[model samples]
Target: MSIICKYTIFYLSKPLNITTSSEAMLNQVRSVHNVRPPRMKYPLWYLQRERAKDDQQLTEDNRAFVKEAVHDKFGMPAVIHGISTYDVRSALREKSVEYENVEWSPKFQRTGLIARKLGNYPMWLNNGKSVLTTLLHVIDNHVIKYIPPGEFDPPRKPYSCPNHKKNLGCLLVGAESADPQYFTKQYCGLFYKEGMMPKKHLGRFLISPEAALQPGTPLMASHFNPGDFIDVRGKTIDRGFQGVMKRHGFHGMPATHGVTKSHRRGGNVGHGGEKGRIFPGTKMPGHMGNRYRIHKGAEILRINHKFNIIWIKGVASPGETNSIVYLYDTLLPLRKYKSSPPFPTSKVVEDDQLIDSYSEKMYKFTNQTITYEEEK
Candidate 1:
């Protein structure tokens, strides 16, 4: 299918003003606001200014900003690996996330913290308070060095994740917003000694840099392609312990027709008198959530080629807004790309015409709800 645009939504930001004395035309001339772009004008602001009479159009800077965004062979919002550490202390305090650059290829997913699932309660809102994270331009993140799998002696200090080779891979990230003075020499020394840019946040991708990218390569939205099926795994919001009625979806006791205090309770949880101690795994309230969970097989919707921003399929993704999400190609057969993915690592390409030509279907959203209209 071809790319389709032009969906209009009205926003009530302020009162609109109309001039009675101003002369008007009979035929619609696609009048636009002089103060804002057509995409942001009436929906975000109150009044739409008349199209400028100067006829001076915006240069590349004004018409629409263009940045070469990443498109990929994978689905949208590519599966990014997430970390689960109760240790809030392990953070750089500035709050950052990580990733690795695939070689400048038209075959990779875009970058950043991606998206985190909030909950299963649905994210759409009438007040506009619940939109997913939007893309923000950050400085091109640089790779420090290719931390080979095996052990090696550095001229200065040892590297991060020194013990396990399998656990560590390539590190890719953006500019440092953290305080340099707060860091240790061992951390600081690792980068300066190797002639790599020091990073505030460090993330390791599963594969080799040579396969996906190179040392010192800059990762961008253009790194990832659209129409990907990503597997998002993250620590769900902790809800504490809950009962089987709530957690396991058990049918509780009858609430009517002579039912008394037993209502809403799991009646007869035990078997006989001798074996009366509530059996193991009996539906009872304990801990609810905050566990590591994965929402698999979500489709990538629209991608802003300029911002590397992605709109995924469902709102049921894993973490909260602004939370960090690791992205990569899916491992599951059902969700994996039907076409062969670029193996080993991706190659850097300048034109990205290959990306424009690849066959991909963006995700779609519908006004339908999940309902089981069946009775047992």
Candidate 2:
């Protein structure tokens, strides 16, 4: 009877067209439960797959061909005889190339930058009032790739407004220098095409096709000017597995009275009749923080070109010290200016030009004491 029961159970659980061997059957069962097979070197498909036709294969013969292709694509005109890197750059700047002139529009959008939080400090205003400011250091930032709107296929629509078109170009930007040797072949290949180092962080920014910038173009702190407002976004510091009182800021039961052992406990989660169970999303003790947050309309207090740092007006910028944060122009209605922003991006001409750029209201630390004169 026991043997019959076991046979019936096995037959009922058997799937169609599977191998009859016990070992194969057991493996199939494990796979159904998403269990990793033993001795598997690569878990993801790309980690172990063969290279595609468009991708340059990692072979000696292919290396020279790939290099030649890259040279042809990005090579300067041979008409300029014997030009070095510096000479080419200088010559290009000296020569004025005809570009479709675009009028400045307040509605035009601009690119953004990724920066690291460099701590905060109090700064005295011109009015003698002190305010805390957060310093953001723009790291090594460069353009990686530009995909035109016609070629760029976004997974989902970014806006629901009927006036706006769904098609938008994408700019691949990277920041924070990193050694290529430490990254995977595919990961390193991304920066190789752009002639840049393997970046520590990479992000895609949607932009108009006209705002496209060629790969290898460098970005600097001057991308945002002082007095302009921006939005900073980053992951907040994580405080894992917190209680209701700490996470939700719930006041605990009174210390005295009949509170007893339930001082810190959340009393009476749900009622006893029709609605007995606790509802979903009810604030309870759970994982806290480590969520993406944005600080909008943060005024740019100053910019230091020497150190590539931007001092923002508020100390409430998301992320902890040394953590990455993204800065984009403010979208707030009152703060949003229709005036054209640095189209595409702001170009850093000479480092000396902006040793330290500050807003009019900001009081420079190096400046002398402030005094108010009585009106006659």
Candidate 3:
């Protein structure tokens, strides 16, 4: 055995003097193994702009000062439990400001709101048809900053038209005020100009220059009217590693048959001949959900100004309950707004007397029961 091992080592140690064509093939295999996947491109603004959480260490006094500053600006913190607190609500309520009157036009686009999906419920129409509706609560949303077309620069240009690059602007919106201590100093600094606390979520909206709003402007559910069609975008629920039956809805093999251990397995993914490898997008067991999806042209069935909640027509809005979603004007030509909407955002009315606004086709509980008349 020792003699055989010595002969094998000697033979393996010797270098092979192969032809140029064979050497080229070996080099090609090495190149294939060393090749790297291409990096994905993203917008400049998509890059992480804030430092890691708690990166800025502060003294006890400094932390207290920051909280106190926020309290002073937003008003005294409330201790009540069941009901919504007044302090935060009051802080979000900004005085209405008059800007140059700009008429709504087909070419103009406005900023979107960041709202939380409050779950779904069934609602009856005037015609007695039951429809499932999703409730979206618009949180304390405020405009943090606005970058004009000339000043706004993205890593990859979104438009091929030079005019579009010059005409479109970026709006930075923030929602759900959070404690300053939980966020880094750089993240908190973003709200400094608006005299607001750090937000739980931040979103960027692209709008025409004409629809640009001032920093600190409040966005409400009233921005969209009942009966208006809008688009919703949200992240779907993360359904981790799942089977073919659950992920792709594939029917499993018969349980009664003499199917060995391949009952739930996805059978035969590849071909026998030239197409030997499994094809991309072949349905198989893998990670599911947790994707950004858009549900377009959902009608606004109702709007509650008091709570800043809007009831969307369908329960098909992506994401699990309590997840944040973006609401924007629909881009569908047929469902697009025919009448004028608020130029920038709805005005912050001091007297929120109008609690609920319902669509014409919706059945209002306050109204009397429907009755049928005899044929004439």
Report residue 174 deviation for candidate 3 (angstroms): 0.6
lDDT of 3 by residue, 315-351 (tens): 8899999999999999999999887998777898866
Q: What is the lDDT of residue 288 in candidate 2?
A: 88
- Give one digit per residue, the lDDT tens place, for model 1 in 308-373: 344555666555555555555665677766664443333334543332221143212343543345
Candidate 1 residue runs with Cα over 4 Å from true position:
1-145, 152-177, 182-200, 208-212, 260-264, 267-270, 273-283, 338-376
> On a 0 to 1 TM-score scale, where does candidate 2 land against the true structure?
0.71
User: Which pairs in model 3 have colliding backbones?
Assistant: none
Cα lDDT, model 2, residue 12? 43
Q: Which candidate has the top score in lDDT?
A: 3
What order do you get sorting by TM-score, best first? 3, 2, 1
RMSD of 2: 10.8
On a 0 to 100 scale, what is the lDDT of residue 87 in model 1?
14
* Candidate 2 regions with alpha-carbon error over 4 angstroms: 1-101, 156-165
Q: How does each model score on lDDT?
A: 0.42, 0.70, 0.78
Q: Supply the global lDDT for candidate 1.
A: 0.42
